[model samples]
Target: MLDFRHISAARRLVPVLLIALALAGTTAHAASGPGASSKGLRLAAMLGSQDAAKRAKGLSALRAWGQESLPGLLAAMEAPSAEVRRGAVMGAALQPAPALAMESLLNALGDPDATVRSLAAHTLARLGPLAATDVARLLASPTHDIRVAAALCLSRMGPDAVPALAAMMRRDDPPVQANAAWLLGGMGSDALPAAPALIHALDTDDTRLIHVIAEALDLIGPDAATVLREMTLISARGNRPFSRMGAAAAPTLVKLLSRPGTPMGQMALFTLARMGDQAKPALQDALATGTEGQRAAAALLLTGIDPNMAHTLPEDLRRTLGGAIHLN
Candidate 1:
């Protein structure tokens, strides 16, 4: 019988030689003449190559082998060395159907090594909406690297992942909540549905989560207005979070420039005043497009920001704040 140590060594040499020599290599000769077991060995060895060129050659060879390379790649994932396991992960990515390899990749996402887990996540992310739930679950993993990998993957899934991420925010699990906020922010405008959740997230005592939510709001920008028209219905205990968002919360506040005495208007005035120059663009937009009262309010609010905007306001629209309302 062939020596076990030699078989392991042969598996390495076989694939490399197969790249240059093809039929001349011992493993290639073995692969060509016989049962799929021999060919599988050839495949695993090639894919497990330490060299990128050889691994790429292995991937090309895998594409040519079509579905035939799968069993061997699956078995290779169980190998003791991380290198071989990574090779198997890459090889599985070649399969046309995600279903064929998803189970294995999911298992791989839990691999002790972060690199292997990340590779699995990237592969899953390529499936678009199909892999969203699986990746979202990883946000709860004890491993920070895995959580980051999962967040980045879900961000790439577009709006398909917004619900899963928004649901994560409701759990009060700080790490998961934080990662979800970061992912939603990365999704930008597509994550608008989660804006209210992100807005309410400021109730957290966790400073890290608070900062993350703020940053996400900044990235989501004007879309924070999704909650604007309904702002009267939300609790008014604090406007700190809205003000914390810098310019991003401006659009929502601009809506309130017309209604002076209302709770929402008071909150908007205080928050917009605090934003200074950051609130300039939205106020300028309002000046250009708002109703007469809105343009008047925007001009009055802008007086604190731009001395000339007050000059641009018609004498009637330039009137001061109403006595009935007080800035919060």
Candidate 2:
């Protein structure tokens, strides 16, 4: 939430903090590491500025100190003034390795101010894997926004985040489950271990949850293919609607082309077309069968796969496939 005015104020306080740190026996040449620098002390002072504008100036100054301002910023986090503590947390997050701010950020997670907590979550999550531990801690936080921040961070972290994400899947809330499933899908093969659970999630009575699980299956890829195939078989054999399963299994539908006798092969081709060209070979195979439904679905998929492929179909086939091609 730091804005233009805040940035200007931070710039103004840099000089003051540097001078104070210089007088306080801290120095760039000292073994104690990055100290207050004139920038940090003045920035800390601004935290006590009675005027909102002056306070913004202080926060802005601290943020500007960046990594070199860490020692001072860390000290400021313990300030009795709420503004100073908030400013310190904000400044620390701006460090290149935000992991350095993990402790301070974690403490701020329980701040009485909702805004501070939310900002802390945003910074930690954006830091990616560096903030993984803190993000995991926040996953169980009572606040919804904190949980959301953790989920988003885990999603961005991809596969490395699956363990924590999977653990949270046991929650009763469908939205939480849905986000967890989506993140697992993004993990690609790393998420293979979670395939069975994800597949099971697709069967939830909630159609919305089914969509989320299906999307996860698509992301889990080759790892989930066998499970998808089995699901397809069970659905077809039982004469189930298979709508949600088919929709979710879009990516795996292509494999059906390799297993001809399974009713799923052609049936999957049509759905693959719905998913786009990854199903090209399967659709091509379907085209040859030329039964009205098979040819029609093939033509539709071909247009999506490649317009050139659609044009390549014989005049007779095109005429026979007219309605399916959707040339318009």
Give TM-scores for every candidate, taking all chains together and pairing residue i with residue i. Answer: 0.57, 0.43
Put down candidate 1 lDDT per residue, 203-291, tens digits, no spaces. 55565675676667667764424545324323343654333355555765676556666544565787788778988988989888876
lDDT of 2 by residue, 240-265 (tens): 64533443344344334333444345
Off by over 4 Å in 2: 1-86, 94-103, 107-119, 126-140, 170-173, 184-196, 219-226, 229-328
- The candidate scoring highest on lDDT is 1
In model 2, the worst 10-residue window by lDDT is: 24-33
Query: RMSD (Cα, Å) of candidate 1?
Result: 13.7
**Clash counts for all predictions:** 0, 10
Instruction: Indicate which candidate wins on TM-score.
Output: 1
Candidate 1 C-alpha error for residue 224, in Å:
5.7
